[model samples]
Target: MIAAKNVSLQYPDGTVALKNINLSVKPGELVYITGPSGSGKTSLLKLLMAMEFPTTGTLEIMGRSYGKGQTGPIRQLRRMLGPVFQDFKLIKGRTALENIMLGMRFLDIPASEMKKNATEALARVGLKKKANTPVENLSWGECQRISIARVLARKPLLILADEPTGNLDRENALNILELLVGCKDEQTAVLITTHATHLIPANQNRIIRLKEGVMEEAEA
Candidate 1:
């Protein structure tokens, strides 16, 4: 779950990345953030991930207040989030399974259980067949899924996907969206950001659009 009220972000350069943003995300909910480039899609995500603090107003994520000077708690909160960054930060030399498992090594899961979850995450993303393939050799789409599998293997309570369908074709893009939606449950919430509004599934109902740092509620 996430909550933001009259939130605004202004950098030292005096550029306001977001303005008067108000949002609330609940468990079991799937929300979409659609916007053009430089429209503050990434800035909103940064607020959620605690990468940037609000220049004004209040914000909270997963019940943790994301106020300035809370870096310690924010760092701990990150461990519970499944973030699929726009950039596929895959380890080039590692196998798909290994890359997925690497994200869980510091968690409480046992080694054997970790592998099981990694394998299961890969399968859920339709990449089980490529589990042993080196990440460097996989296609862009495959690498994207691998990045997703890595985050999913963590069993995060909140899933934040930034442009999960960036470079994929229609089929793959929809497949990725389906996988993301299916990952949510009663105790889990999902928030996805993408510039391709057309790729959003027809069933989606909650959408927020941003332009020039201004926020608006759009019918999905």
Candidate 2:
């Protein structure tokens, strides 16, 4: 569902973050991106999410080409992605259910269906009892699950998880990774970026290893 040909991203200071990143992700695929610090991992995700335009080359995501500075279209394009960002960007004052429903408020769906989806997502994430609890009152892992619930409720075409397992015990990290990869299906593509390479099951083949802004497929 994504194709990047000779894509490179350079910052304003002329520092090259990514160089000639050629990647193709198809539907029902679960891809993992592993690299050390400042290895252009996040840069690639930024390009896919349309947070930054490529300094050189072209990127097409879900059939939408991201031309330079197409803010309006990029904003609209994000609706097709269910992103589980690192910060767990949940609204603090709102309950888990509220935060989940609010993510889909702009999609023009009925409020009742939105609420139903939010509750179902929460239950799926093993947080049904905490649906009414405020986000600020939840634990770190709980908050992370709520963030995931927000994405699960939307059921987007693509799932982009940026460092979903940053700080946690090994069990927690594996649990989080399992949820992300399991979410993949015939229509949804799951692309995850993580430094905990050991958490990725050894059987996975769609792994892209990056170093010094260059990417290559690592042996499974």
Provide TM-scores for the models. 0.95, 0.96
Against the true structure, whose TM-score is highest?
2
Clashing residue pairs, candidate 2? none
What clash count goes with each model?
Answer: 0, 0
RMSD of each predicted structure: 1.5, 1.3
Q: Give a tens-digit lDDT track for model 1, residues 56-142.
A: 988988876866677788877888989998888898889999999999998888988999999999988888999999999999888
The whole-model lDDT of each prediction reads 0.89, 0.88
Worst 10 residues of 2 by lDDT: 211-220
Give me the runs in candidate 1 sitting further than 4 Å from their true place: 67-69, 218-220
